[model samples]
Target: MERPRRGWEIPGDHVVCMYKIIVTPNASVRGVASKVIRYASIGEKEARQKQEYERFNAEIISWYETSKRVGLVMISYPPEMFDAKYGGIASLLSVIAGWNVSMNEILRVKLLDVFLPEKITKEFEGPRWSPDKIRRKLRTGGEQNCFLRVPIYPRLAYPEDYEHRIKCLLKKAPEIAPDIIADSELLFNHEFCSIDKRIDIMSKFNKHVESMMDAKERVETKTGCKTLFFINVSGKPSYTLEKTEAVKEAGLDGITLNVLTTGFSLLEDLRSKFKNLIIYARANAHALLTRGNSVGISFDVLAKLFKIAGADIIYTGAPCGSLDRVKPLDDHVADIRHRNTIVRNPIYNIEPALPSISGGVHLGNLQVNILLAGVPLQITVGDGIYNFPWARNNLDRIADVIRLFKKAIYIITQRKENMWDDHEFRELRHKKCRTYFMEEGKCVDPTDKEIKDVLRRWVYPEFRDVLEKWERGK
Candidate 1:
């Protein structure tokens, strides 16, 4: 048997990186990664912490079966999926999903004013989902999206509060591994970066980071389960490579990385160097858009392009996790992970994709998210895991979420029997966002030329000088 090895690399103009996803027998233990990870009792605690996760699991299953509710569906396009909150247009959705209001009783609004891509608009050509369509889609699983988000802000506790809070954060990894580890500050403007530069937070920050890293090590050491861990280096790119190395050193099984946080040259350099890190291009490409929703590359196109550029994975979106873009989300994920058909065997691994089902993931939505993903999915969770009320700590909830999530991933990955009847299964798979084909021709997939333009025309040319300096160690 070949021992699986993972690495990253850049092939000339293309940033090419590859890593394997293992489905090992011992992989199910929540924190005990006895094989791929080993670290000191870096942070003291027996491998027994995973036992507490039993509590984490129970609370979550209870929530899902009980209080979870349907939230509103916001509809507004925003550039940069990783940046600021999408349009303030989420009131309806917030009221619905956050508040759990039913859609049928709500009033519907028809509009005459409009702005949309010509190609896309032509398909709908002046159509919006009538309430009936929306209801049908929702009921039929044709369209429904939800999200659970955890924004990894810097340790916000006051200097006095830091120790205990940090300890709490570190100690609970097993009980509360989240769906989406923002692994980064969800929102940081240029001003914050400048502030980081002026202050000496770098060293102190690492100490905090190390504590979390140590916690991760303990979890992997004990439970052996590897849930998605989004490590956002965008917070500090200079430290990113090293931090990523630390993550691997700590024995983390997977990570989420953002291409926007660092220059292409830096990413190229990372690909060439570590090769072990599984890079997930974060956010919408920063170079590509503005308030004008027109003229933008689709996340699907970007994922494929980045894969070609050496990214091994991409977070496409949840079933419209935050805003209800299920139809489109479904299409994007399918387009990315068509998997190995008997005939294709290996279909170029085009986007080298992981349609990371992310967005607002929470306790209430776990099973629904499982159903939405249809199997073989990476369910990224965040707030749902961290924000648990202490008596009912969120960590246990996270454990349960992962258990359910992995159950889905495992079954799908194994080609298990479809538990849903054909009619129900087809209905779930037939999400509406994927139906954008007005022209009778099979739509052509994205071309790498557009990616090249973004790279060469927008980012690389400016990035060359710094890269050269870094390469030469000047």
Candidate 2:
């Protein structure tokens, strides 16, 4: 008797009715354990099951020729498997990376990427605020097209202290005005500094900054740019919604969510509800899934998913500085490129999200970061700004460090010639390269002579030639 046909075998014009996944199959075996049957009459049932498995293996599994066991495979699933309407990112994730159940046949698998049809793409609202719109809204112009963001950790005494800290930074060097000031992911709703208090303090501070900029009288206030405050709204669904409501009510600029922890569904919900608020999606926790060589999902896939879930800005790990210790520079660069492509590339008519580089980024390697990105970026500094060598002695010098970064970025971006060869670039680097030395952990302030020695011995030698090569190619 003829065996029952598999989905792929019985398919006719299933292009729109299918979603595809590329996975590296480390092991492929029968999902069900074989059982010994006592009766000979039941042999036909087992024979039919065996035939079904063979048909699936032959027709559906498109394996790539490789030396490894089982090899890589591309699997396609019928649209019926997904609930495109009711089921959101969770369901899509299950369809793509749920190897434990739906993909149980593959004992070990690494999900590389996923391609959803237009029908699936149309179901979700992508980023409401594209990077271009954000730039226009902030009235960012000239050589300073890329955004400078500073993150405030939760070491402050109270929510008001956070406001005071930001005010102090801007007051010291108004030119150091960042486009976006965000609360660290570690800053949650503590008893002393609740989300409400933080929002109230920051919203008022934002207004004050706007007023100062509008007046354009005080040289200390003449930043010629607007600052946006993005509070961390990552929490349970109910708490997130409540905090989002407070943010909107207080007329705050934006909210950030740890997408990996809170899940992508919350991101979509926030986008749908608060169409105007900029949603920054943090995927720092993704290292658990993406760090492996031959398991879990790829950063490329996660980047795409973040964009699809309506994140205006996504924090992709930095390619240079501190994160290098965790992974090779090449790997980090590859991940950043993937994220940049996903955010910048026009696909399915969805608005693009802004790719942000954060960990261990500073003025020294800032030019290198921009060159590698080859696109507009949100260059975020944490300890890079807060713990600068000059700032260690006097917090006011933090502004000077920011000013130095602005000068360097302007020279690098605006100049037509190679930045590395430019006199101004070299001068700026020599004067301020020491700022990059003060990262998250290493807080010890080095002497100016020590700084010069370190730069000459390590930083300049390591990055100079590389930056020159990159600049020439660009």
The TM-scores, one per candidate, come to: 0.39, 0.77
- Which candidate's TM-score is highest? 2
lDDT of 2 by residue, 1-474 (tens): 222121212223111111122223543222111111111112435546666433222123343424434344445544555665567788776544543323433344456666666666777788888877887666655534577788875444476668767776677433457778888787779897888878888887878877776676433322336778899999999999999999998887899899999988888889999998999988867878877666677777788789888898887766555662355445456556666877776557567788888777765567656666644678888777776666756766767777766655655555533444556545544555434444433321222343333323332332455444543543
Compose the digit string of candidate 1's lDDT tens values, residues 125-161. 1112122322232121222222122334342323333
**Alpha carbon lDDT of residue 381, candidate 1?**
58
Runs in model 2 lying further than 4 Å from the true structure: 1-61, 99-107, 154-157, 172-175, 217-224, 324-327, 416-474
Where's the lowest-lDDT run of ten residues in candidate 2?
32-41
Runs with alpha carbons beyond 4 Å of true place in candidate 1: 1-182, 185-230, 235-256, 284-294, 323-351, 387-474
